[model samples]
Target chain A: MSRPVRVSPQELRQTLIEAIVEVAPDVDPTTIDPCEDLAEQLALDSVDMLATLVSVNERTGIEIPERDYPKLATLDDAVAYLVHAAVRQVDAAARQEEDSSI
Target chain B: MPSLGADMESGTLLEWRVKPGDVVKRGDIVAVVDTSKAEIEVEIFQDGTVEQLLVAEGTRVPVGTVLATLQTTSDESERAQAPSAPPPPTEGPSAERPRVSPVARRAAERLGVDITSLHGSGPNGAITLADVQGTAGSTQAARAVKPDEAPAPSVAADRQAAMRQAIGALMARSKKEIPHYYLQSTIDLSGALEWLGKANETRPMSERLLPAALLLSATAKAAKEAPAMNGFWRSDAFQPAEHVHLGVAVSLRGGGLVAPAIRDADRKSVDELMASLNDLVRRARVGVLRSSEMFDPTITVTNLGDLGAEVVHGVIYPPQVALVGFGAVGERPWAHSGMLGVRPLVTVTLAGDHRVSDGAEGSRVLALGGRYRQRPEEREK
Candidate 1:
């Protein structure tokens, strides 16, 4: 139950678009795509993008502090972040399990 | 950017609020358009001096095109017109409060310390301490008590919850966000009712005068008498009003409250007042009210007397400082010509905003009640 599993690529695409629409209602949602950068396509500035980050944090509760925001430039970046954190958690849990068995 | 989308897509240039060179704020309406929707007004969402009108009013362009560019006043904003620049999220205060962030909305949650329901000047209407402290109320309701321990809330516990919630939202702003105080007096409603009874005898059912209409008259007169009560409270300052919008709080049947204001109540006649009061009540219950109906109420009056309430001292709805609450004008024994007699009486509670006037000044403004000297009685508990 604790092992990391791949987050579905399809789910990642859907949630990212959902997060953008929730963050920026005025932007035409039909034009939004996961691959399209928010700043270049939807005209989101630093503050508007911060609001989007807040929505993500509120939904996922992954404390992606502001300093790490530069790493999240595209939709794949978000998926990678989630997967990498899950792998770390699972690796720590496996070590604990191996110690218990020994 | 000052963008004018023509109404007919090609209607003639009707007029402009400012000539090409005039300065305008972000939301100021720049030009009126003759559009397919009708002669529509076009507004600018950027602050800059208008350099030119891009197209003559009669030119027809597809809806998706640019109306006008505000001219390169700042290099920072030249990019704003381009979707690529990411229009700096100004987040100027929207009149209708929007959904707030769960975390930034702490002032309201602090209970009696913040008012999130008011038009906030903060980021996206985030509840601010000043707004809460001004009203002196919070989203916090009174502590729960056992049924055996304390009296029930005046309205239903659940509906009271909604009522309190709505009241909490509305009052959070008026009490905390706006500077308010009250000025009250007892009206000798005895003569007015007598006059109203005679007026009712001659008039048709639809035209009869209720006490509310007369109360409306006095309030309008008093507000006009003291224009200071008509304005809104801005940050750390008070702006006396130019319009006298009167809000009357109508109690709903199943237990909720609605205060719908009659616009320009000062200029309206008794018959017009009666009609508007009727309309405000009907639409208020069904929830079909137009947003304009709630926007600018310079003064508000709340009457709980009809619900067996002796008197209700009102909370000022922020910005506007005074609220007059009407109590039952019941039949009570009184002295007429120094002899004991029965008469109908009305008690009015005036809640004032000290930001503008003090208790002494409030009493003077309340002198409108003096004209109604025939009120049945004056007794306070």
Candidate 2:
């Protein structure tokens, strides 16, 4: 049986920074504070936020719904949200696999 | 038919925003098209009932191809009463007119040059500004002229390459065909920035206005005062746009530029302009621009402030008679009331079509833009 791969917070943070850079190349990802509000610090507008979300989704294969977008206000918050979502997705897949096997 | 841009030879019809039997009015978005740069929303020009969609979605057709049939108010009733009556003659070669860029038409008017007497040197033998300007009193009606031909279908993959090719074609044509004149003005932005600061202080972070919005608003007002710099040069003369739809240039994330029009810039408040500009920039980067926004801009405003440029002398987008460019705004030593003081200043440059308007008119537009900046409150009205 194959086990689901786990995404670490550090890896997620790197992914988030890469995604942000994809949307706004002018932004210096290294200077971004993990806990600071991205909109306030980087002047990331709504469009940039959407682009970042799309890029992260494409990179990580994780879907972040619009309703949950408000929870992802900072780099740290996004990393945490992504980690939790990935865990949930893995759990759902495992449960479905177990039911199918039975 | 709408020419989205000079580089766009053909577009693939993506989807219809309005279905058959739907009533559509002027400026109403009816269809969406996939262009070389982005997917733009296409708007119709007249009030009518959509009789049928002539072209199915996903079909790549050349520019000037009719994608749909609209029955005007009079025609709708006539067709309803006499279903068997032969339809009005289709718009065929007999009704076809010589293809001439709007700028060429306007230039021909100014120079009193007969455009029909000259051979077109532009793509598909379309009359260009240079062709009109080059042919003065020469009875060269027999000049070898090529017939109009459809541009070859572009490969959908490698969007960046297509974009580059499109940009190259347009820029090359602009530089080669248009006789451009440049004008520059140093505007004192202290008053405008002061007002913006106060206004932003009272607004939320997301709603706070950017300096670019103020500059755009001032440009629109300036366009209103200096009408010559505010419209398309077409049909042998300058056709001043009834409304100021300012096209703001935005750089995409994947490396291309698109300028979508902010409709009725003169009528909108600064806050409204800010919201629209933000939305337009976001959509432009995301590649979801509407067709009307792509083709409706009568004038273009490019702000290179964020890039840290001190001045920008931009090339005029074809059909558009003038392009207004703004450079970085910074605190500089200024002489107001004969006293030296630090004030925010920005260098404004206007690249105008010499055939349509001279440097004098371009200077007037820039001066008006500066004057509007001093009275920033008037923009809200």
Candidate 3:
């Protein structure tokens, strides 16, 4: 299967906030800054984060590994990881196509 | 609405899932309540804007008490502000209000009631869980049930479901865990009928001895002779029952069963036993059986004779080491005084838990029925 491209930093933060909003709509998004640690600040447990992750995956095409979850607790973390990962995938696909062309 | 739990009478407003002025749809979980059964997320009954959250996180309110207001506009928060409401209904914390806003902050400074759940008529939904906690007695109305649901917290509903769940878990665990041994015996019941008939002629219908009334009488007599077969098993210790509480298993037409005990079954006579049995059966049918009635069974007596069944090998009700299954009786042959004779007979089955007793102990208890020569004489004995 073709790997999906990474989401933008803004989009990633929006995704996380949307998950929280779905669970707690009364909460103000401004209070839940993506740069801040979700666990320390929002008191998000691993289970809560898993729910958010599930919600995010449902909306996106990313295939994040379970092992990679610790790297994406914050919005900046998710964006940086997704962007770098997407670039590598795109480069690998382009190289494969070139070899096939030859 | 689906209930969060059976034991959840009320919950602490840990935090509002939605804030004032936020829009929500049906099925939206609007807040979290700390139910004794579980920490449940209270869902929106319908779609609307959150006008104000009446109770804050950590602030307690009984179940069905409005934690927040949902209206087409912000004006709907007033519905919860009614003067007639029950006051400061919080969960987890039984006595004090929740700790949320500044007064709650000062109080939280002193650990007062939390009120972050309170939506500010002050604007911007800034009233913290602390603020609501500070304004004690103002939130007293919050403790009350809504106008629509008279008893916001149906303790009975909680109790019944809790009782069922508890009964469910226990029976499930027991059937899976305990090794049961069942034994049955048929006795000449002709004497029981004639004895009861003569006794009823001298007494009123309200006090007349019925078959179960007689069986319970004999059961107590039997239990006293065989005390080892009564009571429960605990870790490293076995507790033998002192009082003779007779558990009469009443089968509801709906198909499940409950046993409401006749307390001090040994103390009552045939007439008194019948009256108590009638009251217990009535309460058991309605699911309003009390703790003592539902529990406190030193032994259980389940009658299947009414259903026209001849014999039944019953399951031992847990904790109590023995169960006596009563079945239909018919006239049968018996060798009496070295001669063959036909006599009315009834069969009693004893299901005992082997962990607490042996087959010999169960057999010994059943033999005590033979000691009571007359059914009427049992009442006086």
Candidate 4:
């Protein structure tokens, strides 16, 4: 209903890492491999993964459907997915705004 | 510091959330304590106004030491009548003296061991029960205390070692004392999974339930039905609990495990259990669980499904009489209504204390759990 907040891939990646650290403080951001499965590498359980995802959604205001959770297994894939979702949201918001003005 | 676990001998007081003159009720978190396994928020167990804090922050003290003094609300009338009762000494005469644990002091008094003449081998040169007992056993008790041990290792590595020690000690005690018997049953979970999938279709991502929630709730409900498996073995006797508090064994991110309770699990719905389970796991991982959560579990449930374990025969935490373990739910050949077919199944195991319960009670618990789990739709309420 409003303008979607656009985020660059690097910023989205940083946001994901921050969210993870917020939930599991023992996680060292420096040790994370961007291409590796985040949960398995960090030994995070499903609840931790869900909390991290929820924190990310709270920070970015992105409505990540549950079906898309598997696509976010790795940091690189998560950033790419979020970046594309942000662009689509922005486009949809712009079209809606234009229609309302008419 | 109150005992956070069976093996927690002492804890370092990290910070006080409340100060003198603050009013605290039962279950209010008053301080944070750093144990070997995790940093836990210590809760007050009575309604009172804080009068004085005996232990300073950053000081490590043994369990049962008086950390703070409180003015109970119930004693108002007594205080009013005896206004001159010497204000209950703020500090004892032995304050600022030897750093001896309460248990060690008692042992010293009983065994006629001179505590002041000996060096402590415990953390920060604090005397422990072992130090006193060893001294009483032999003439030589002056072990060199290592106050300035080599600069401490990384916190994570140090914690890992300490956690392993704590778990090993408790497990050894369990194995040596309790006669444990294990029973395993494979439950057909096709109905529950099907019900859960349909239920999730109408909910949001955050509210969607996991299979573990169903397993936990079912175990809780089953324990309520099978009372023999729902209590503790204390004081050389079996004492059944009034309500079902299921201790959820959560594995930490780095290592170690803590089983904190979800109070009154049998009364909660599946959705409610899921929410509590999510919150409990989150808090347990963050190392901020409350004191009662650590102490109030009547029974424990360990789920190793995520790790792909087929079955778990958990060691019963001391005092508690039973442990329920749920393994991975996978497709397997099964006979349903006399027809052979492939179905989703889970292996549930029960480890019961032979001193308190026999195999019949353990079987009843597993059977009831399976029944509850089979009817996921009915439990949603």
Candidate 5:
């Protein structure tokens, strides 16, 4: 079986920024404050947010549920959430691989 | 029979929402049609029973082709007998025989005016161009215009290809047919932005306004002042639209773009327009749009600000005579009181049909838009 891909926190943050920029082309990633609300700072509407989520999912192969979108209100929060989610996904896949081997 | 838009020669009947023998009320969505732009839900105007389905699904027919037969309570016999001859082919129904000239009929159809509501003033009680225009203006004032797709994770490549072809055809037709005259002006949006910022402070994040809402409202008001710039140029003539159904160009995440109408934009407040625009952009991305919204735009508005463009010279979406474009709103050196200072400026461009209006009228429209932006409070009024 192939080994699972590894993603670091900083890498995840960059991916998140790219995703946000892809969704809203007008937003400048360098100008975004990590702690500021992305919706207010970037003027991201619900549709824009949805597109961002889709972009993140496509990039990281992690599906974030709509209910948990509020947790990703800021850049830092999104990065942290995505990193944790990615780790958990890799761990779950490893466990399944072990179980199948047994 | 619905003429989805001026460019649409025909639409494919994708599915029938209502089956025969089903009871349907006015404003009920009876069928779904796949137009050149998008799949649209078509609504029926008369309350009736579905007598028969004349045209089956998957049939691509021209505009004004009768799709189904309806048995109405008022004229049950006549309608039931004359199933072949459906009411005059237009978006809305004109139940009775309204005395309207051929030109007037075409004008009413293009303007989304209900002929039955108009009072005829011509000889033999016939409705003329003036009569239609008068009724359209008054009807707009009298009527208080009160006004989602499944998660497809993977973008459909075929849909994108189809949309690209459709857009190419439409743009080609536009360039070939319309004599377009372009005019642009840079407006200082400092006042508008300041007012918007202050106004947004009290509102919730969900209800907060975007600069697009302000632009749309301003364009609608400007169109109201310069009526010649708002309407369809069809049948070798120009028909002015009384109400401003502003078509907003929304880019899809996958590929291509669709500009659906926000019906009666001048009548709606900025906040209301924001809500409508949000809904439109969301649905447009998801590929679920109503028939009326697809076809009803009197003029089109495209904002390339998001793309960071300084100016956009857009092609006129036929039969719409004008297309208003708003480009990047950024800080620029300005002279307000003979003093140089940095202010937020937006380059607004108007691409008008030279057949119907000239640069002078287009300039007036842009000036009106700038004036409206200067006084943001007037947007809601």
Candidate 6:
């Protein structure tokens, strides 16, 4: 899938918060501090954290590999990683489509 | 009808999946029964042909009431006779038992309670599990069967209230009848977490393992080591169980909770336990649990830590002599090898029935659980 319209960093953060809330219904979105460790702040266990990442992937179409999990310690970190990865993914999809057209 | 829980007195038959002349095997979901807690799918224990349906849809029958009559199936069909006018000979060890609930009869047989001398306090003066226990212990066995029982409510608010009452009855009974002795220990989880991280590094989200699985496995393994804390307190004595059927407390999304047993949990590995936990939680919330899962828990383990609780002092479920609880694993001040530092630590607690065991035996359970968690690689079973 191609994302002709780019998603902003703010939107990515919002998506991350929503995903976290979905994984942990007990967690309050308003209480989340973007700079702090999300797992620690929200009491997200390993399974909860993994589920949150999966929910994020489903929403943004950005696959966060297991190796890159450490990069998502905080909300800001996750947003930055997703924003960068989405751009790379969109660029790759665009190039592939252009090649197919040729 | 199966005694789904200690709090259950009667259940309303919702639907019958099997009809007369249909064949059913052991573990087959024969019918759905609605208790105060949830809608449970009742399973038949013996392979037999459905001879007749004794109870109809929407009939609220008390525990031990025969829902249907089954003619035993066998290879020797040549000797098979038509369904006789008289009731077929009762099958299994509970056969020919008069005035005793099936579950209570089984408990009596196990606990060596002389049913002939005791008087039943149940409906029609039938010998119930509490009656059998009363004969064995000095403490009064709580009467679970309510005489003026209300109909199963349909609305969510009413259902929630009903669940609250059910839980309240059980908890009050536990506190009143069982003299509980509690012991707590702080377990270092740095080693376990490190191992889990390395183990999950290459796996996808769906295949990854959770710390709760490890804790449960450890508790099951520990129950095996601490035999005194692994069985029921019945007939004024401790009846040690042969297998570790670990009860897991799963809270529903709507409201309230159910603690169902994972049979032979000690025999399962961490990966298998994780899979079972996932499937169990899914089915439990959806309210389609099996009869055996509801009835056969030898011990219970509650992990309130998953929801961010720092510590738990859980009440022991009746008949089961012990309850194991795990709090959230958090970074805490630790001293290791003469150095003070912060480490991921979990506070594990054991609530033991004083009538059956002492604090030393309870401590052994926590100690063994701590060892297994601190050294996950050594958890062979």
Whose TM-score is greatest here? 4
Residue pairs clashing in model 6 are none
Task: At residue B107, give the lDDT of candidate 3.
Answer: 29
- Candidate 3, what DockQ? 0.01
Which digits, one per residue and each the tens of the lDDT, describe model 4 over residues B81-145?
A: 22211233333223233445433554566557799876775434656555666666676345321
lDDT of 5 at A71: 92
TM-score of chain A of 3: 0.69
Per-residue accuracy of model 5 over A1-102 as CA lDDT, tens digit each: 223253698888878876665444323466799999887777665557755776677667775654477799999898888888888888888899899999
Candidate 3 lDDT over B1-381, as tens digits, reads 123322234455654556667789876766644433223445666777866556645666665665555675445443644422333333322332232222123222232334444444211233432233335435554542222231113542453465466557757766776778888777777677787667756642234456677777888778766777777766745688888888887754223566667888877776678778766553333223343354367888888764557888877666677788878656678878899999877788898887878888788777776445245464574
Highest lDDT scorer: 4
**Candidate 6 C-alpha lDDT tens digits along B1-381:** 779988888888766777777788889988878887767888988898887766667678778777777877664322233322233233322322235543444456555677877786543455655566556554334522221111112344566787899999999999999999999999999999998989888765667788888999999998988888788877778899999999998876446789999989999999999888876764564455778899979999998887778889999998899999988888999999999999999999999998888998788778888899999998853
Number of the candidate with higher lDDT, 1 or 6: 6
DockQ (C-alpha based) per candidate is 0.01, 0.07, 0.01, 0.19, 0.04, 0.10
Error of 5 at B127 (Å): 49
Q: Tell me what TM-score chain B of candidate 2 gets against the true chain B.
A: 0.74
Residue pairs that clash (backbone atoms under 3 angstroms), model 5: none
- C-alpha TM-scores of all predictions: 0.45, 0.64, 0.46, 0.80, 0.66, 0.71
TM-score of chain A of each: 0.63, 0.90, 0.69, 0.93, 0.92, 0.90
RMSD of each: 24.9, 16.8, 25.4, 11.6, 18.0, 14.9
User: Model 5, residue B244: what's the lDDT?
Assistant: 93
lDDT of 1 at A98: 100
Candidate 1 lDDT over B176-266, as tens digits, reads 6545555555556677777666666665334555677777767776787786566777677778887788887764423455565788987
Winning candidate number (DockQ) = 4
Docking class of 3: incorrect
True-vs-predicted CA distance for residue B8, candidate 2, Å = 1.7
Candidate 1: global Cα-lDDT? 0.54
Instruction: Compute the interface RMSD for candidate 6.
Output: 13.7
